[model samples]
Target: MDANEDLSPRVMDANEDLSPRVGMEFDTLKDAWEFWLKFGRQMGFDARKHYINKNMNDEKITSKGFVCAKQGIRGPEKENMIRTRNQDDTRTNCPVKLYVSLVREIGKFKVIDFIEEHNHTLHLSETIYMMRSQRKISKVHARLIELASSSRIKPKATHKLMSREACGRTNLGFVELDQYNYLRTKQQKNLIYGQAICLLGYFQEQLTTNPSFQYAVQLDNVK
Candidate 1:
């Protein structure tokens, strides 16, 4: 699939009601993000940080904001790549947003602006748990998944155990595919520079022994 494909079928727009009052203060970025997450759960939408600005002198935060996860249209840069996952064009240029900035004197972040209107349909309660921003594999669960794999337990069994502990599958707050995605990301990080250098060295040895041996590295358009 290309970036134009949307995994979720569109429904009617959500009744917008929950909103953050302008001038609300937060002690840290984490606090602000958690507040937004709570709002999303109640309002049937998701939020994501799209940009951040920092103070040059102290490297302190100056400004940042979260927008509807489906805030903007996909850019052309991703059009050439294989859409293995998460390339859905669900974004409708929704203007819903929450902007905040630092109050240097008091050293707290204050909400500067907000737009609660969303251009696209809000997620229904049943499916909201599946949204990227709402669901995540926490560190403790990730460790359990790793241990379960080591013990050769069937993945389905592990998932079932977790679901039962959480009271049911839906209450588990994540699915098997979500755990797989998290593991895939963790594996990528573990294979970073160390593996890259080893592979390049192997290729170089091949080139030295065989004159015609050749290799090339590929990167996406953005790189």
Candidate 2:
């Protein structure tokens, strides 16, 4: 398949109705963020961090919260125009939030609470793909890709391996074959550049030691 081709959406099975649950634990803050991002996409909404609580002494994050972008306001200008005749002016006020916090005992972050509600329409699957977070690869996924690339595995195979590994958990939705291909191509370019540098150094050494050395350059004229 072409790396850019839109693959089929991995929908949940009809029999499986696993909803986002409170107290879901993750190994690290990054893992927590990745899970919630996927959860938001699966639920047809966008996720963003509202705030992060930190420890004063160590300056480490102790808790983090996320909120839907659509939860904030629904076109205040439109609302103001509609209420022009009335004396009172009111705007959209949505209340939806999810909080996750670190548990010192377990050494993992857990969802403390989740307010599952939305005032706006859910985003389409195609539109969700355009979301920045959905398209960006997470740190864990990047590491996996690097490992796979070092083993000389193809991009498609690497993606398949990642998908298989993500089974029964929040899917690694951000890691796409196109990304893997791009990374591989970048690595190839770096290797070529390094080889060229070595060759240049060798030529420079020969030119300095040898008195009788000639180098020729050619260029094509184009209008």
Candidate 3:
């Protein structure tokens, strides 16, 4: 026999029927199959086919229309929670809902934009300082000197170091100039739109992404 035939397949622990390490966890046999369905997506296996094949091999389980579906109802009590919020409430409809939901998301974008703009400005200033120290002033020198006094940027430098920190020292460099201008313009527009949307109140979930059962908070609190 070939040496390859002697090698054993990786045997999972016999006592541990569900492989938690492989993202399969089960509180019971039914839960194990359910978990297997979800896990199949991650593992590149079709869980539905696996379940079907298993059912085919089992006489009792296959005798039912579908093992789990045959025995279980959708459960009446839980149905109301998943139902769409009433459309009659125009105050809580589509775009308004999206708008409300986006406030936090847009706010995050704003904070990030500020940091990026500030960093770019600081870098420009530093570059100007380095150029002046080296005394390699060129076209960029004229632009930086111009920017130092103008609202085209902001906070003009009275001295060399201040200019570096303020205008970010790209005398006439289009890349630096374009970025500063673009971000200032773009961010304003985005903020205005986001603010308007906020007034409408979209995406406001009564409950956060966390499981309802995980927290002690009441349903009204979630709302």
Candidate 4:
């Protein structure tokens, strides 16, 4: 009946639900936080704990907020320190956020506010897993890394194998550098353990040769 009404574009609230929305309820604060984290991962950003408000009477959680990891800039006092150190501060004061409050009647947490706008560039989907909070060495990945190292396979080769098994690098959830770091840490642990074992063996041999052989180990301040 009306040309303007007929020409109006269809609505797109689907994507809004894809992210967090106001009045969204969760059974627990953890659920809300995890949901927000999932939303951040999907949106190519990282999230951080923002604030928590508790009821003064019962000391129960009244509200909670999760914000973009890059939400705040370095303060003025830190400006000289940062410049003196010749290091860059990554914070941009991005406003992207999710906040929820406890609903007494429903006994759930409801999202009171949601902001999707970000002042900084979001991470690319392909390399999003490389984010510090996202990258982790799982048990399976650790076993594979150990097996590969034991078999004398290179770190890069092991990473490729993991990518192939997961069908893509994104699915693998860690970059090649992570694999190298993990190997380095494992090697350090092995070296320390080997040193302790060698010392123990030497002590055992001394005791066998002379039952009264006495030795004392003195540790430095670091220990």
Best by TM-score: 1
Summarize candidate 3's per-residue lDDT along 1-223 as a digit string, tens digits. Answer: 2333312212234463432232222233444444433332222222221122123443323210111111123344434543554322111111100000012222211101100001111113224223211122234444444465454445222334533543544332223444345446656878987986674443234234433523232233544
Predicted structure 1, TM vs. truth: 0.69
Model 2, span 1-223: residue lDDT tens? 2444333334445564336578778799777666667677787776777888899999878999877755555376766776786743222344667788989888888889988877667768656765545665655666667787789898778877766766611354554655656697878989987997797788788889996875654545968
TM-score of each: 0.69, 0.46, 0.16, 0.63
How does model 4 fare in lDDT? 0.80
Question: Which candidate leads in lDDT?
Answer: 4
Report, for every candidate in turn, its global Cα lDDT versus the true structure.
0.77, 0.68, 0.30, 0.80
How many steric overlaps are in each model, in order? 0, 0, 13, 0
For every candidate, C-alpha RMSD to the true structure in Å: 10.4, 13.1, 28.0, 12.1
List ranges where model 1 is wrong by over 4 Å.
1-18, 76-88, 185-223
Which tens-of-lDDT digit does each residue in 55-154 have in candidate 1?
Answer: 8899988988988888887666654342555565666788988888999899888999988888778889887777777776655677778888779887
TM-score of 2: 0.46
Which is the better candidate, 2 or 3, if ranked by lDDT? Answer: 2
Ranking by lDDT: 4, 1, 2, 3
